[model samples]
Target: MKLTPLDAPGYEKVVYAEDAESGLKSIIAVHSTKLGPAAGGCRMFNYPDLETAKIDALRLSKGMTYKNAAASLPLGGGKSVIMADPNTDKSPELMQAFGRFVESFGGMYTTAEDVGISVEDIEEAAKFTSHAAGLNKGAFASGDPSPVTARGVFLSCLAALKHAFGRDQIEGKTVALQGLGHVGMYFAEHLHAAGAQLLVSDIDAHAVAEARQRFSARSVAPDDIYDVEADIFAPCAMGAILNADTIKRLKVKLVCGAANNQLADDAAGDALMERGIVYAPDYVVNGGGIISVSTEILKITDEKWVDRKIEQLAETTDKILTKAKALNASPHKVADQFVEEVLAN
Candidate 1:
């Protein structure tokens, strides 16, 4: 395993690891440790090449650092990415090998579920190391973190709504969701229960069908979702959908979603700002999953504690919006400032 510390300012450290037996190659990027121990999820993906995986890991880890600090969690930012096809490459032995790789870090990084990973998979990884979360255990169970993450996104949606429409209630509003996966479904359920109209889409037809029946969502084609007429656009799928082209087609006034690394590039946030769209930083609103899992790791297993932290996300969102408005800067810039302040101290 070769570990490299990126010379990038604001990012404290970065490391890459690989295991041959499981055909697993991973990059563990630790962006900061000023707040607390590094906390992030382990994402598994089938990258076209190692360079792409490294870039993904580095970008995600930096996002995690900003995310934890913005969410006011006593944790730093770090992430691990396994370069393998989740569809056919996952196995008990492979997961065990990954866990051992995690253990090699000596507790410097704690991991939970992310894309292409499940709670059960996390459990499999736990057998090789105790740093894994989402396992059923004594006095606490680290089950799925999506619901908690969705709650944070929901609250952030409200914050964005209040900023854009001057209303806190979604009762008569419409939200166009771009994914119906775990976090998206949870977000849709909450929004539907609150009497909000939901327009959802996903690459997986079955997931979309389930959401349509369960939440009474109006389904749209995945590619056409951005053009849907709605009060808010919630992108719960992959990142970079907020790039110049998609942003030009969006009919929503506000954008908030659970996906990490939403911006295609740093300049995309400015593009949203220029379009008069109230955009919430993806990292800020998506920290609930990591926060929930980290609380369990610290033995603060109370649901109320998790709820409180999630609720604080709304406050942070409000602050970012306010700062952005006052300074006439993009919310992403305002959020970056907040994270820089935390890391600097």
Candidate 2:
């Protein structure tokens, strides 16, 4: 195992763990444990290079810390990235190897599913340690947090829309969706039912086709979808889409979606604010999935219990937007102040 500290500020502990027998190689970035035990998801990706992987781990872990703190969860922030192709690199042996790597951390960090990782992968990783979520089977089955995550984002978007436009309903509003994966599809269903006009796009043709047929969604090319005239731009696919180029081309009044780390850099949030876009903090809106998994892990089985937590996401989002307006600051800055206050306590 080789460990290197990321040059990025605020990341104090970063390590890469490698296992030869299981063909598992991973980077564990523990950004901060000041709030509580660091917790984040384990994501597997075919990173183009080690440096990219390290940067991703560092950034994601730091985001997790802020996410948990902002949500008032009793957990710090950390993340793990497996350097492998999710399509061909997933195997029981590989998973077990990754589990062993997770075990090396003791109880310092807990992991669940992120991009390219499934609930089954979490189950597999559980074989080596108990620091895993989405493994309960009593009432609400564990693992696969996308539905809850999508629910949170949808609700938060609604709250942001209400605060920004002085309306609680999305009726007749147009929403341009940029991903048709699990979370994206679920979100589209919610928005469609709310009478929002849906325009969809995805790298996967089948997903786009399915969304188009089911919702009568107008299909746009992935790159061109950002330029579509819509009331809101929902990016459910990958991160960094809210950078200078995409933001410059954005034709929406609000940017709220399920994508993690949507802003390529912190400055992008300011840019969105400057453009008069209401930007809901991604981590705050997308925390429903983790909150659900956390409840399941703690053996809270009532369906309403999870629903209540998920619904509160909207309230939190509303508060952030309201406070931002009151302070005449960007929503991101407002959220940061909220998180800083939480962490301080």
Q: Note the residue pairs that clash in candidate 2.
A: 134-143
Candidate 2 runs further than 4 Å off: 1-9, 136-141, 297-303
Worst 10 residues of 2 by lDDT: 1-10
lDDT by candidate, in order shown:
0.85, 0.84
The digit string of per-residue lDDT tens for model 1 on 198-267 reads 8999988999889889888899999999888999999998777888899999998899999999999989
TM-score of model 2 vs. true structure:
0.93
Question: How far out, in Å, is residue 18 in model 1?
Answer: 3.5
Give me the runs in candidate 1 sitting further than 4 Å from their true place: 1-13, 301-303
